[model samples]
Target: MHSLRNTRLPFKVSLSLLSLSLILPIQTSGLLFKPLTLPPSHPLSLQSYQPLTSATTTTTITTNNTTPSPLTLSTNMTLFYPAETAPHKATILGFPSTHAVPRDLLNQTRNEIMDLAVVISEFEPVRVHVRPEDESLARRILNERFQKLEDINNNNNNNNNNRTKKAKAKRFNLLNRRTRDNNSKEDDIPQYHLDRITFHPCPTNHPWVRDTAPVYVLDKSNPAHRIAIDFGFCEWGGKNLREINVRNEPLGLEADGEDERSPVSSRKGYAAPDNRHWENARFAKRVLEREFDLDEQAENNEIKVERVVSPLRLEGGALEVDGEGTFLATESSIICPHRNPSSSLTTREAIESHLRALLGVTKIIWFPGRKGLDITDCHVDGEVKFIEPGLVVQNKPHPKTGKAEMEIYKEIKEILGRETDAQGRKIRVVELEAADPDLVGWGGDYDEGGEEELEKEQEEAAGTYVNFYFVNGGLIVPAFGDQKRDRKAVETLRGLISPERKIRQVYVSALPLMGGVVHCVTQQVI
Candidate 1:
């Protein structure tokens, strides 16, 4: 832990980002999302980790000679879904728009998003998807706030927040592109400018792309040719918590034919899926159209990067892949009537078969997630993270966690500790305890939300530290201003991961109101 290093901002960058955006032949303006409109921040050229390449991981996932079809609507293509720890070519984030985010939560959401985008840009190229309308605001925030001290070289160790007028002003040392003043004396600069944060034109109903974006995969022989699997994002279930939809069935799921619980979201309230929600559902297809030329590629003899629409109504966050033929998911999110209404995908075995064909998943691990618990219907991503095939990271039950929620955390750990992976190896589960009650607004008077917010947040956000997202050479973990716990998480993760990987923490405030953190908002490219 003592040898652990924090993420260091690169001193210089190049115009390659500008060149990448300019040189590429983009699509016509008539389309909904014409390719990227801005240059990425810079490439996170990590010396320890290889830069984005077609080379796959050393670990191999073996399958029979027969190629499997994930769904009835199929090409006999076998897709390989990589683990989160895999090196990223680029990272994506959807900008907060007035049409998507609630007015009350918009500012907070945008601020958090901007902060996240800036931090992630340090590790990899960030492709931010902005609504055509929010592009101006996007530019304004990036230039005005993130581009601080561009003309001046402030290499001083003054990286602390300054409190004034009872409102602490956070000084984000988001050193803009080495595309800055040439007068800076810093000599150790990044070899390339791959870590650029550029804005692209793509509207999303929600800023959470983990649910809306395509689940990327690759063909084993040619890894460069990426495949986008559109699981048909249905606003977590084609129904929102603010809507009038209720269920008479008991969550439509069970674990080992055990406890059957009712849908918690129905008892609360519901919000009907609006136009924006539907737009999010279709966003993956839009992204595919904008980024790849499937028709042209198919006609060619070269590696064809294509996409497919899976009848399984799923979100990226709902499913977890271990690169090695194992998949972890929850029944509430995938097996529910709302997400899988089609009779073809009704049973657990049927859904598992689809997963096997779609992602080359040989083993399927199912958890009984609580439906109507939150917008995502208890996505498995909120529960566990597979660090590797046999190794995992899970959250310890928070001190203030309720009985039901605590049981979930305990149950997950119990299963992980005992269960063997697809490789026939005993699982290694590491526990990451969350921040204190006082620090995380368990009962204290936090400025963000009230008692109701706290209660909701506690249930859904039980082990958020586990939700930290992985980048090329580092992970963007959430910070709740808890000095002890947050630091512990960083140190623990640093110890478990490769020494080359850095640990960077960002103060997250607004996302908890919606029961998500950094991982909820970001997605990695193949």
Candidate 2:
């Protein structure tokens, strides 16, 4: 169990004195004595009292550099989140665990997982805990989720609810079948069954854990301290083709005329597929508990993990903070019309408020982002990161290829130059060129269904290197196999990081097909 203690001490200040009598020049003043007619005092009352005066005055002085002989302050520390200096803490990762990716990609992801596990274990004992839907908490969350889904279904159903008897029967049968299947699974599945995996059964199935997972932060003033910031995530703000994008096509949908089953009907369908969200949450909880060394009985049996929810929907990928007080973010994702249409907070206001409340931060440095582009609009991490206080590493636009994006980069540089932190410290921006542009097709297909479809496809096809993830002791930078640019990127990052931190490259060829990269797939918990 964690223990607490206190200490106390005293300090003294030095004093100096000088005599005014010795420093002043001699002066003579008239001395006169006058006695008015008064009654004579008795011998006992005639004693004289002298007035008090000081020729010398003492001055007490304090210096900023003066070292106090003894001082006391409580120091409480924990290794819950791995320090950048420490090589042992495993970097938590949120992968694009989509089933649509090629089988080889899955194998590679598995390998990467094992590699990360080994690295973390070498530093300290590691436990891989997947998130499980807490049945106790399920009722509340499920009720809320079901309400939302029902609203959407009802809205879509519109006035069809009061249709003729025959039509009502058909709809009833379909609804009844779905309901029965769901009920059976719920009854058969044991709450405590360790083997069972559950998915977040929300209709907005953009279950990308990295985009939605809570960002954990430690409170410097408190002992046994940690907090989770839930960043709001959208479905990449509707970048991919809603229906035709094969990579993004929902699971359980089969060919036109096959014996395909709805996910609701399959035992392993939805549960096994979207387990990443639950897994991440569970892993995060365990890490916090173990790191703080809380009393097992009290923490496990009594105290629940406390969370501070930020209404401002921010994904960790969109935010990059220096270990210090400053954070870097872009205006695009935070303020995009696509993410929050009715939000009262503007881009600047939302950022300032969010930083102050969530990060205990006073200032947020913003760069005018590439707007009206792909998903996430433009996450700040794709543009710049705070490598250290007052210093940044930015993704430079390619001079020859990204002509338009280069203009955006120039604007970003200008903005960064004018901005300062809350402490009035100027930010130093560094530039690194973006990866080479690939020949991407609209939704990875040559044909466009219509003029509107063509425009949408073009927007989704733009390739970006800004979406990169920084892993534990390494950077999982995305590479599109453009040899020249890829090599330069690797070299640029290696120069900034230490030799101990490996620069591992992950080739995400399939990202452009759906319109994002590695950073989109992972969110870092600070």
Candidate 3:
């Protein structure tokens, strides 16, 4: 046995060196050698080569080829969903900015539910990472600070924060000590303090990042290629009344602008401007170019980001795909004058063509959506989502207050019954009730000039949980603290997803004031 072990040493060492040579820029000639040979034992042959059960043996060999090659980690393979099945990988969520609610309310919603880790597991067994607005802000702040320091050194000491502080100190020293003390005693008077830390002003309050962000899709024909769909985003057609509503502002613009203007000591930094739909589309095209190795001529093959022009302007929040070829959208969102004013195709044909061209959708299920009742104009995601192909979970009307909603639901059923996809298949529809009727409209706040006016407005705008966000691994649904209703909604969602996926219920008291719920405020990237 010892002699046999010696025979194999040369071959084993050569194999190891070969493996290392492939990874490193190393020569393999020195590691190769003539094969070793071992003679059979004469005693073993006499004993008929009987194996000893209690024999303990160990062998050691030394060779020049000792180090192993570094392991190469492969990029994740992209998975394609059938458009009829539940998504098998990452789910993208767009968070609305501005008047959808206050920062505390948004943070509370994020903290209480929306477990990102679980969402990613349902599609692919991995953790989903969240890219929030704060990341963009932090990057902007650091850039500005560096620019300020550079300017101060160049000018021999004239930076905004330092100059402002010196001016304040000079004025304070000139005043009588008693008078200065008295001035400081005026606590009610607001004193502007220069923040040494530079910050990027928050972008417009249109937190619907999902709509503005590009939707990523994998090509069925080429698994290695990905397509990013840049759906046009509008400011909910100018329906929101919140101060945060700045039409067409894109993320990261504020930071960029601040950095550019920081060197000019006399120039005041301005808030970030909105990015137009065309701009976002261009940005999406560029992202695909960098991330995927797509070439300009790749449109014919390989990978390409092609913009699908639509007569009907739609945001990501207004549509939901069922992994299968089928999708759900509302007529109100597609047909409203606010979106498509002079389109030739009557609402139905326009929708059909857009879905086919952009998503390769063969079938579409339409539902009756409320017009002039919400800011989305009538997005279906606020009402329904496909849990599986041929299966849907729809938001239903409350028993006492949903008379109009119920009627609309019936109309939707009839439309769905007659509608077929490009493949000529009928769609199946299911109706779900709102979790709590009493808890409806619980978190809505609007400015009304003064405290008295604000109080009057609160009496009018209540919120609903029907508008929620489906994040990567969890459902960020709204809750009004109507324990009975909130719990029911949670249970309903849990039953829809596998037990491994968690349902997070975020109380969105502030969203209603912006004229919608979680669904309206968010867009999902495919």
Candidate 4:
């Protein structure tokens, strides 16, 4: 049984990048936003990086050798949602089990998460947070993985050991780029030692860590210093309030809060059952700050947390940034009245200012993303991603999803094509067809209620290959079992990434059903 040690740590507390099993659909994307000006673009490099040397603190890097930029604020904090290829200290993951989910669904979800974690660990470290009660389960799963890997490596243990040593030597030389050669035979699978993963006790609401966890930034002045930015989460602006309220009720029906607080008929609008969800974000910030040793620099005058207490509620997925100056976002998800009601960002200028301050992007490209197209109101990550600086890749619209998405895609392509990046370079956009529904595979059949209902669920399950996540020298992509398309997606993505990077495809058929992909569930610590 999962631990019930703290009421604050309930099943609903766990969040993923995609959706949870909760009825109201806690699946969504965004980041906490405020206004700031776009600073000039400058080249930044990880000159002093030393990976895997310290478990508690990440290696510091510098932008240049002399007259470093002043944006580092004594806090040494610069929010760079740069290309995923940028070096990462670790990746964060959350595990949750809920009574609301069937056993088969829960098991499948956990296994998939484990698969993702294992693959990510191959490139960089992975820090997993689980309820105290589930620690044993997590360990058992990881142990089995370790054993399986050991058996494989054992076949040629001596030769593999020599190769591992050589790889480590090569890794040190590429510290500035945080890259490594992709020529190793054990490139696809991680080592058996399991030295890269650290399990911690943290409570979360669902597993959408990317959306719910605090965003990390490095100090502009001192790239070594890190800060945790806690963007507030309210279950997609109380869209999940009804489910939270219902779960809180003893009878699981009828209104529990005052009418004024009700999302259905409230002057204040829908308030979550409690701020327990916020705890996960807060917990992540605290834990990460400590792990990264951001606090010990007490003399440096770093704020423990940078809270973007803005009316604009956002998930990290809503914004795509190229650390240099270019930023991409959708208007419907961030600016629409549904998500930003009563926010101070009433105009395009206001929105731009907020994004600049919060995300540090100067040039903003906005797409008229369709509202209600997905629960997230259309996060940009699902449709577009920055492969590297000045280069963006977008998914071609699927005929099955309809005209609204196609219209949005066309507008995005046109705008991006005309616009220039913050660095004053014409944006380069690449097009790749989104994974079709037929290519996507599900773990098990849905309840035999009716074909119409099942069809609706399957339609929603159509996730795209664009939702892949980047690691040190690898790209972890979602494989929907459509053999042909899956292989093609892999090849296409491989062509876009640096030669040093390889592809790791994990079967995540369930992620699409929840309105997310691999990037949704994982939040990289840069």
Candidate 5:
């Protein structure tokens, strides 16, 4: 563990941060967290072993394909961060088994993810990860979905061809008539690119890749170089405890099925049958190693992957970064004692220092995230997202949750309005309205769960459209069943994004039922 070096911050900048340190002060009083005592049985503590092996000890395996072999990093790897709107090499997504998920809503969630993958493929390459047994199921769904889309496109293309032929025959008429373009009308509409999407076998505990998967970054020393940041994840502050406990039972065999488990599940992070939460993190790294290896080999085999390991227990969803230097996060998720105990991070300065070194952030804005409001402890991804360097998009409060839940949004907007970006430009905030109540409870009734589980679904069903991903030339956004609100969201996004970007929307009602939306399941490689 000592072999993995901590990244050093620049001397001049370190002095600057020390002199201009800013704390939450009285503005975030109740949010000030105290250290927590870890349960005796809990595997996580300040000194607990990391979920994955030391970077130096990571195994190197060669695939039969032309791809480069997975490499290891004994020292810290400084990574180059890219803005969310930057061009992406590819996007990674995951799908859970129907057995692991509630059977009643399995089809809904599966179709939503499939639809999301298909739509995103139209813009940039997409990779869908599934458990080994579910690989065929994923392929079948995507194939059938794309085939239908292809048939429609073919029919439309035939009609367009006929129109073009008729116009071509009358050369003088074509000159008199507005010169018709040869391209089909569907050219304006993004057609699904089946070739752009590839399915891979990657067994995961859940489908939320944004949290568990390795965050991609470029090497600062070499722009062509790529790095994978394996920041340790503890299953969203150990919210997976219930799921892990249930899986340890005998009846659990019937619930999730034995086929879903991966060989990586036997690692140190998953040694304890009672808490298999960290298994997701371990398996995610394995999947990313393969992705990085293949992508690098396909581009430049000389460029090797540099792995960076961090001991911090945080989820990618908890913090939002504008590729430049500004970072947005909630105190309850990162600064909270539950995730970053004093024994580990020690002080706010120490925590911020870690973030600055790892994320290359200059300023971190902290908000008092409502504790227990959602599983992620009010992750900023749900409330705030950066469209560009100085432009931000925030979620509107749910109609059912009312104004009380909206106070946070108002506070954040007010503060951001006064703040400036790395280039010293005042932030421009855009508000994305909430989903209608009628669409909130669309899929909750199908699941026969306990009152507590049902209540959680009700609270999360109407997730805002703010949680969206920015691809190369397009925006992948969530579309709730509410016809009016969905269209409004697309219109609002068009106003916020540049006119050149293609906006693609998918019906993602099932995501809210599981406590996340579009952005939660996708992570882009820069």
Candidate 6:
């Protein structure tokens, strides 16, 4: 059983992100929104950065950044949605709990998170929202990771005792971005990078903060200012609300065809009593509304953050913004019956208008994303990512993948070939191949017929490389144990992205099994 110790530390609570399992339903594409004069495009590279002590603390990581040009949009624009590559004050992730990672996979989940947190902290500070009960366990896990690193360093030092000082120093300062820590020896993640990690005691139903957390947008009025859009979540159509080990409630139903399935069937992610993920939704709002109960920073240094409440319900993983004015999303993830489930929000125009009002979105490049595929109904993050406005990367499925999955990627390529972005720039699409499913080995953990739902659902997240997270000066990508493909992924991203930004892969096994990856679990506060 998972520990529920009552020891309470100084609580700092802010939480978000969710992943749901469901089938995919194809929708029509091509809804080009009218153009709007948006904020100028800028490259994200930080000469300097401020540590994130609160959610509202604003920071910029833009190179040769420019102010927003005057806008002629339908809505009076204030909040500017920066691209994922934009400078981030900090990145937030939730520590996996009982139901999210399952009991048997808890150790693997924690280890994966440990690898992610430590490596990410090498680039920027990380905020981990750990439930109060799991605080000590989380700390222990990190400390163990730190000690393991120290041992490895010690071994290296012993082996290369006669190495020259200059060679050692050169080997130590690898990226040349982070200055050496004077206090620590060799500066090799001294103290497991624990100094860069801050823990917040909070409640979380699921740990995919990309879906549950606030989608931050920079304010055009003030570049140092930010707005947190709480695009309310419904547990990915409430399909993933069920805890692990919960059996799929039988409804005397079976699949009719690929395009059709019973909505109430609970076969994908299992059925829970209700979503009950409202705590995470409320957590999103509290960040903007309340005083930082644990904020230690001075008042003058804090960046101003504004909040805009919206009726739209979607996860951060569903929408990909170019940090200009264009938006990309799966149609089923946003406008379907579950997310925008109201008479007023039914139409495409209505949903687009709300997006415009909320984030000043000018053009929406819609893909016929299949609904009920994985926990996200085919979240766009799993398929495509905007390197900037014009340049983007997509996941090309393994050749052995199902016809349904292959067709989806083919459509994405076709759309990119035809469509223009919000700023009238033709999009450039790069294809990144996913790891072969047969080659992805999850070392005999799950019970036979345990969590593997169905053949179609399993193929959705079979080592997808696009679901990666962006830190301040780094990209956190998943490694699916395929050495060749994993190495190829790093090389590809390095060639495509900024030279200063490093591409690091964290070996992920359990989350991908649950239909999520690095991007699903992490959120950036810009």
Best by TM-score: 5
* lDDT, candidate 1, 1-526, per-residue tens: 0000010101011111100000112244454223211212111101111222213221111111122233322243356888998888678888876544545556656867877776677678887888787798987776654543321223323333332311222212221222112323344233223238777787564678888787778767567657777775655553432211122212112211121211211211211212322355567766666554323334433334455555455778887878898788777778876654434456787677667766878878787766655556677777788877788887665677656556667778777777778888888888888665445523222232321322222223333687788988776777665556766787777667766565566666555555677788888887
Candidate 4 structure quality by residue, lDDT tens digits, 27-126: 1123222212222232121111112232322221112222222232224445544556678878888774442222334555565677677767778888
Model 5 residue 3 lDDT score? 5
Superposed model 2: Cα runs more than 4 Å off:
1-90, 94-207, 236-241, 244-304, 341-343, 400-403, 422-425, 439-467
Task: Give the residue spans of candidate 6 off by over 4 A.
Answer: 1-77, 149-192, 241-277, 286-303, 441-461
| lDDT of every model, 2 decimals | 0.56, 0.38, 0.38, 0.54, 0.57, 0.58
Better of 1 and 2 by TM-score: 1
What is the Cα-based lDDT of residue 388 in candidate 1? 72
Q: Write the candidate numbers in order of decreasing lDDT.
A: 6, 5, 1, 4, 2, 3
Candidate 1: regions farther than 4 A off: 1-76, 148-195, 241-277, 293-304, 441-463
Error of 3 at 501 (Å): 4.0
How far off is model 4, as Cα RMSD? 13.5
Clashes per candidate, residues 3 or more apart or on different chains: 23, 4, 33, 30, 1, 21
| Model 2 lDDT per residue over 1-526, tens place | 0000000000011111110000001121221111111112210010111122323231111111111121111133221322223232233433223332333333233323322323232223323322232233433433343343344335334534433432322221111111112112322211111112122222122223445555666556653454554443323332322232235344222322111111111111011122232232232333334332322334434332334333344456666666555666667667654433323334465446545545655566676665544345566666666555677767675544445566667777888889886567888776767544433222122122221211222222324454555555455555544545555666666666655555444443334444445555443433
**TM value for model 1:** 0.70
- Model 2: ten consecutive residues of lowest lDDT: 1-10
lDDT (Cα, tens digit) per residue for candidate 3, span 241-280: 2222224222222223322111100011111122221232
Candidate 3 clash figure, as a count = 33
lDDT of 6 at 359: 70
